[model samples]
Target chain A: MNKQPEKYQVFEKENEILRHSKDVLASPELLSAQAWQQEYERLAQSYAQLLGEVKLLTSVSDRLQNKLNKANENIARKNEELTQTLEMLTRERIGKRATTIVLILAAFFFIVSELVIDPQLQQSAKIFGASGLIVLKVTVAIALKPIEMILENLLLKTAVRKKMS
Target chain B: MENFFLEETSKTPKLSFDVSTGKFLMSGRSIPENSIEFYKPLFEWLDEYVKKPCPKTTFDIKLEYFNTSSSKCLVEIFRRLEKIKDAEIVINWFYEEDDEDMQESGEDFRELIDIPIVMHMIAN
Candidate 1:
């Protein structure tokens, strides 16, 4: 009868030993961490490659932006130059119109001097009148350039003042 | 199908799509003020070409410069070309040897489509 109880205790202890062995097998140590490490490394490599590709694309975009900026600067410079040239040409045109008007008025004066004033002059008057007429022609011819220059300079100053305002 | 030839202009490129040889060429600069209007005829011709495409079609692109709108149109053209099946489609991309941007642009297009693209560097 004492042998029977001892045998049952031994059997139950053997069963408990088997259950403990099963628990050991199911522990976290059986799982390989290296698999997760390898997957992490693979994802890291792909992330690096994507970063490099994005960097290259960003570099290309910056280069193109630099080229576009240079082109815009060139266009602005050319446009400014064209505007200045046009302004100068317009001033010169106005000066030329003034010259034409002055020339026409001088012609009228010459005609009046010749038709009315010249016939009324005596020999003495003729001498002085002729000299005065000659002087008038010379003055008109000499004043043409200075007049145009003055008019253009005035227009330029006015343009400058308007721009400043 | 009849051949399509458009002369190059200051704001456009030269396009010669020969139906007989199936050798399509687009050269020069493409920066038109009106992209849709300028490329309408080309799209029309491509529409007709897709209906009766050549057996072995090829595209040769040699451009010095192109704008954003032109690039989009070019992508659309490639998309249309992609629809053609059972025929070989080869695209040759030409660029200056010193032009890295053009080569990358070709690479970008290659990534976008399935057709084969070959880059040719023109020596100065």
Candidate 2:
């Protein structure tokens, strides 16, 4: 019975204190102060959330900048390589054209010597001794043979180089 | 002696040979698909010209590029020029200032062929 009464008394004391505080806050000024405190707490929470969002956005911006820089560097490197390749190709093309011109001239000379010069020499040789004519023809052939061989070797080398490249 | 003038094509060089004027110029690029076919008529003309040699035969070569096979043809041309005993042959080799390969090519031909050759370097 004593324990039950003590519990009842403590509950009554708490109720009284709550009623007194409510009566004190009945004034408009006091009520406004309470409302301001609640608003300040809400604002603080919102500020914290906004700060977190700003931090996330800053990190994302830094990552994007790094990616863009890497992409630019890669593009620059590729452009340099492409330029070098184009230069090399131009040189090779020029070399090939030069080689072709030389070969055409050689062929022309060979045709002339074989068709016209050889026949004239042969006809003259017939008037002279066969021995002299044969020697002359052989000498001319020998002289021309080296030139022909050199041209053939050069052509072969060019073809091989092109294939290798 | 007849005049042989072959117009320049995409694959061949320009050839202007005049028997009267004795101004034979072979210039531009030469990279023909069939070298023998392209040069046959030119060789025939040269053979005919050799019989009645010109007083002054000036061969101007300003080729930008040629192949190894073409080099042989050049040698043959040089030999023909060398054979003219009664005529004066003046071979002018023109190259670009920055082209070392062309300069060396001129030197090689000069060494191999016995002719009065003049080498001139021009700005490309």
Candidate 3:
């Protein structure tokens, strides 16, 4: 009996078939007519079974591949969603910090204007009216929004750069 | 006979075969680098078990995914189990509700193996 390569054999039955085929090929005249017919029938049966097994394996393997592909897609989508959410949260946090910083600066300017600038203006012969002082405070208040926006954008860019690095 | 057990890993499934209860389970994913090497002991254990199998044997298989080589090993496992003519063997094939591929794979195994295979849907 010729020893077939183990790597090429999927099952013992397949190995047996290969051995039988080798033996028949080596001595074709030794097999009687009935034995030859029996061998043919057995080969046919094994072929049918092998064909069925191959079909089933192919179908199952294809399905598994599809499943894995879908799972990979799902993971990618979820990762994208998580990254977006984190970015939104980071933006919100930076925006709040910027707003708080602007508010504190605004308060300091108000106090300095009340204590120092107001007395200077009161003594200066009223070159500018009280409404001018009101307009100055209003302008500072109006600048607060843009200042906060600039600070938020700067912080966000820094954060993105740090992450990339 | 002693029970055969293997812990589940990232790339392989969990395998547990109890001799006392005749309950076998293979769960999780099976995409090992070498499936035959991984499943060799289980096949040997089954070969010994069939000789003195319990009156009623039940095998529960709940695999989310398996590679082509692993599928061939699975077929070999089922064929070995089909040899237990003296015992009442049943295979419970579990699949996730949304996993039509797994369900159909189980159905395909049912068509090939003689042992009674019952399809079960795991609720999402």
**What is the i-RMS of every prediction?**
26.9, 43.3, 2.0
Best-fitting candidate, scored by lDDT? 3
Q: Candidate 3, which segments miss by more than 4 Å at Cα? A: A1-16, A123-125, B19-21
- lDDT score of model 2? 0.70
For model 3, state the Cα shift of residue B122 in Å.
4.0
User: What digit string (tens of lDDT, one per residue) describes model 2 on residues A1-165?
Assistant: 124342233133234544555555565476577776775575565556345434533443444455468769999999999988976775566566655666676677679978988688778877887798778757865665465556556665776698679
Docking category for candidate 1?
incorrect
C-alpha DockQ of every model: 0.04, 0.00, 0.53
Query: By the lDDT metric, which is better: model 2 or model 3?
Result: 3
Candidate of highest TM-score: 3
Of 1 and 3, which scores higher on DockQ?
3
* Residue B124, model 2: Cα distance from true site in angstroms: 3.9
Question: Worst ten-residue run, lDDT, model 3 chain A?
Answer: A1-10
- lDDT for each residue of candidate 3 in B21-52, tens digit (9 for 90 to 100): 99999999999877777888888899999999
- The CA lDDT at A133 in model 2 is 74
What lDDT tens digits, residue by residue, belong to model 1 across residues A44-161? 6655644544454455456567668978999999999999898878777767776776677668877986787656654545567777766755886788678667766776677778
